[model samples]
Target: MDSDEDTFDNDNVDSGNVSSGDDDFAMEVDISSSRERQTEPEEYHYEVLTTDQIVQDMVDSISDVNGVVNLPRTITRILLNHFKWDKEKLMEKYFDGNEDKFFQDAHVVNPFNKPNTISVPKVTKSTTDEICEICFSRNPSGMMTGLECGHRFCKQCWGEYLTTKIMEEGVGQSISCAAHGCDILVDDVTVTKLVPDAKVRVKYQHLITNSFVECNRLLRWCPSADCTYAIKVSYVDARPVVCKCGHTFCFDCGENWHDPVQCRLLKKWLKKCDDDSETSNWIAANTKECPKCNVTIEKDGGCNHMVCKNQNCKHDFCWVCLGSWEPHGSSWYNCNRYDEDEARAARDAQEKLRSSLSRYLHYYNRYMNHMQSLKFENKLYASVKHKMEEMQQHNMSWIEVQFLKKAVDILCQCRQTLMCTYVFAYYLKKNNQSMIFEDNQKDLETATEKLSEYLERDITSENLADIKQKVQDKYRYCEKRRKVLLDHVHEGYEKDWWDYTE
Candidate 1:
């Protein structure tokens, strides 16, 4: 997962070129950038975060809210939670309205008014000795917590309620008062004072600390299972952002970043791939070997009378009936029609559309197959590491074999991007204008497989230098063709030059 070695803080929006030989589709875009970030062909971006930094961002956001609202930071936090952390909308709607309703609803009744001293609630002596409102047990008024709703409950009852809300569920959960019908949100400070377990309070702190990132639209916690690091991007039409943890993902869809392809089209293609339509296409496009040389021959043009072009073993045969040309008695064309076995599975007009889809699957299946090849190619890193260690035994510095890993990673990324571009091309929607794209795709596929083959072969000390140069050369060639393909597709998408039908 080596991305361009850029820091997360460096989100400078910049422009780049995507040029095909004589064609160009120009558009403006913002991409992640940093100075001298990508040192080699196959690396990406990452940014790690510290707990202190995360907490500071939270504090800063709250402080900003407090400054604008002219309230204490704690009150601002409570108001933020009340509105699900949307400060601007909350202010626009309720800033000058009945402000006390928010404090009362949140149960964050201000102990101080204007400033100066704490305002204490008037405690009645009779109420202290009277029945405890919730548990029906007698308790001193000081031992009971009272919300602004005037509902008094024993500390034990409040503690159990808070535990149930925060511990039985997630710590950030908010619940109402214990008084039968009171819906006022019980404040966290009250929950902390009542709960006996110290660990539960720790969870509350953790929740509040990360709440800023969790609640913001522009920010998201990295999707990595063990990593809680969060990333932030401006809430605009942003491209994918790479995490410090080597997780690259799209800011818009929150899925893996698919550049040079539309998210909508990618979604449709994935769902299409999930169905068996493409799988069936692979079967119908099947090929049979030439009669003499055993070379697999696929029918491309019309007429069943086919001749093998393999110079050493040219053989004439019928494309449909699949036998020697002499078997047709020199004039019979019934072989052009479906034989009994073929007629059983024959579809008439519907088969025409099916054949079109099968044509798409011809490209798509290879795209996906190469994508799988890229994954296995990435695993080759481990194998390359072992080879490097083995080479070190011969007094060759580990640096000598390091080139192998770099070349492989570059090839994998290029091939993957290459594979996804076919999906883009298939859905480009401009059927009449894709001849050049197909040419680029065929060129890329050839160079890509050539590079893959070179890297995938066994590497020993004997052919290390020779194979390294071959991988370098093939990878450069593959990378060039890959870029040409994607550039053509990305330009088509950006400029909307191709009329996307689906």
Candidate 2:
């Protein structure tokens, strides 16, 4: 019969729907029915049989059902199957019946779980001619295999078989043992030990290790019948897969699989799943996309005139207000909707005389102060120069004359005071304060012209004494007038003719 037909036949027998005598007999002899048959004798049997006797009876029964050749094997298998006794303790108890050499040769200890060991029927060198059970090939050295019936095979052949199984059926899937009539599930750990170098091994190990972490929930292997690889879902909300084989991938990783790298599939999946509703809402509320490049951006403070970083299109927009280049007048400051005419009119209105009067006054006072400081510096320079000239005329040594001239030159180049005067004057003009000095412009021009001429003349050794006296007299007069002007500007002093006395 075909496998499907056989499976259907077995299902009929299992479900007790079949009416054959053999099927009825099989059901009657099954474990559940046997329990009913043994119930009446169970208490009496327990009373007569000691614990050891009961165990021996069980061993004998198993041996009778199988064969005498499998007596010890049946006993061991029965004990192991029934009670979860430590393998080591079971070995110790059972090996007592065998010779010391037999015990030593047959027993194997479990290293990881100590005190757990088992014994196999010793295969003497003479009996070691058995062929490798897996590939039915010659058993090579270093090969090891596990059997559901507790048999072992050559390590080399076992490795090859395991590799084939993993490369074929993969880990965590079903595969029968090499031994006929043995059906045990091969776990991933066994497969890993079998073919440590398989391509899937690394991925399997990663899945095993990371599976416990909640973040790795999306990591899964291809469930397709023939595929051996695993896939990771890049985004939990989106089911983006790399392969056209319908494998799911993480949203981020899935995007890489697209032709132009668009995450349309992932986006659709996310919308369907709605897995990131909270996160999406939060991001939408707090973040904005660049109007030009479509990149997500976060806004800090200030008016939301956002400039795009894309070189191709540097579109600026208000993030908070969602106003575009139109409102901002093509500039960040100009919101797309801002009325340029209205803004200009408002600015012009503010530029009227009264609005700027306070700024003009502030700069005017600053300019007067700066001029006073410049005058003081100039007076100091003139005094030093005069003193140097007088000392040079007294027939001072060359070193002394040089030192005086150096000091005078340094004072003359102390242009910080002059720079301050020029800056203040610029501010006065900028702020409309220069109008205050317009009336005296000609007098100031004449004073500057005279000062320039006086500064150009050199004081020689012969006329140094006379030049010194004349410069000192002029500096004193200039100092007194500058002090009066400064005090008048700062203190609102009466500007009478006596205040300007020479």
Best candidate per lDDT, number?
A: 1
Clashes of each: 9, 21
Write one digit per residue (lDDT tens) for candidate 1, span 1-502: 1111111121221111111121111100001121111322233343334455665665666677766766655556666766766778767755667666646665655434322322233455664453556577776767766565566767888787777777677655356677676565555556656889876666666666556556666667666445556676545233556555455566666666565677787788887888886655554445556656878777778777789999987789876555567757656545556644543243342366567777676767877887788678767766666766876786777677666666665666666667667777777665644777778878977887787788668767688778878988887787677678767776766676776657
Clashing pairs in 1: 2-44, 3-43, 3-44, 3-45, 4-43, 4-44, 4-45, 46-244, 47-244
Winner by TM-score: 1
Local distance difference test scores for all models: 0.61, 0.39
Candidate 1 at residue 185, lDDT?
57
The regions of model 1 sitting more than 4 angstroms off are 1-48, 82-87, 94-127, 130-134, 171-173, 209-211, 235-237, 267-371, 391-396
C-alpha lDDT (0 to 100) for residue 344 of candidate 2: 46
lDDT of 2 by residue, 71-136 (tens): 234223323332232344444555566543332232322112233112243443645444555555
Error of 2 at 308 (Å): 4.1
